[model samples]
Target: MSNTGFRVYLNINRPDPSLVQRFGGIAVASIADSMNRASCISGKIKPLNGAPLLGVAITVKTRPGDSLVMQKAMNLAQPGDVIVVDAQGATDNANAGELMVTWMQYRKLAGLIVDGAVRDVAAIRNMTFPVYAAGITPRGPYKDGPGEVNVPVSCGGVTVKPGDIIVGDQDGVVIINPDDAEDILGKIKDVLVRETKLRAEMPWNGSWVDEVLKEKGCEYID
Candidate 1:
């Protein structure tokens, strides 16, 4: 109820597309450990379409069930940027529908993520453009004022700011702060290296568990 009128928006720097692009091929589960098992959104949010999402986040904070500010976000988003909407996880009303998604496609956006609900599942599923949401409903959104664009917002369970790298695949979505990209990218390489070696050994490790048990001096009695 506070600040119901237009709030001045902040200018957020745009992140390097290549940095976000680097994550498209990396699995979210693999990077989970590198992120300290944190900085991931709620699992409830997932893609309406199976396609993966990767781009800089153009963050928006909106009132629950409203698409007015979301429209503003879509208008402001650059090509190859993802519109990340914080709708406070509303389920009673949808935050977007087919029309907005179509507009997103026309704008050439990388993807869309709503921390609430959306409609038009069938239409969205028919296409390759990715749309992630917490739920789907027949309900539509309310167009009202009083939302912040290009600002820090919480989508699902993660705090995302403008210019942060956002990547999502079939498994789930994750955010990487622009400031932490270099460190995280290095960790990602390390994780991939370790996983590659472990995967190569998994098929040949039928006795590995029993071998470890023997190493631990465990005895079974029946």
Candidate 2:
């Protein structure tokens, strides 16, 4: 790798389209539950809209206020790739805005997820593109160098690597290591089934709560 700010790796191992398809319909919350609730992205990063996010991760690690590396990553991204940026959770400067996001959408990218601030909220809200960020600022970003692409990076308290599956929705985003995709998919299916069962019983009283309270040695007070 060069010492330059534009450190990028090409030919990342993207997950199979079929596998990615399996995750697209699953809710981000259900995926997190299947992962034992350990890989949920921090609440600070939220979706810009209700559009669903499901694609292979193109991990980017950049300076808090720089987008040069991010721009490079965007160029390297494929039609269905999700550019996941780790900007150290900086909200003082906007790392991306309307122009940048518009280009991504034009390229048919899956989505953009930034662990830093982004700008142009008004225009972004008007589009169907899925964008998630920790904060928003009009300060804009510097195009200076010093970032890496397609490497392991942390975003919103979770570690993400190139080729990881990124799933997001109204709830939030979750990263799935491709190595565990099959197993996680199986668990997610089970979680969905259980949720369906529980939903069907909503009209009935929740007697299970009483069992739990008694097991914890709770005494009746009245």
User: Evaluated with TM-score, which candidate comes out highest?
Assistant: 2
Those runs of model 2 whose alpha carbons end farther than 4 Å from true positions after fitting are 1-6
RMSD for all candidates, in order, please.
3.1, 1.7
Q: What is the C-alpha lDDT profile of model 1 across 1-222, one tens digit per residue?
A: 546434535466987767777787888887777898898899999878888888888888888888887888888788998999888898879988888999998999999999999998999998888999999899888897578887778888888988889888888888888888889989989998988898888776568789898999999899
lDDT, each prediction: 0.85, 0.92
Which ten contiguous residues of candidate 2 have the minimum total lDDT? 1-10
- Model 2 root mean square deviation, Cα atoms: 1.7
Superposition error at 155 for model 2 (Å): 0.6
TM-score of candidate 1 to 2 decimals? 0.88
> Model 2: which residue pairs collide?
5-146
Clashes per model (N, Cα, C within 3 A): 0, 1
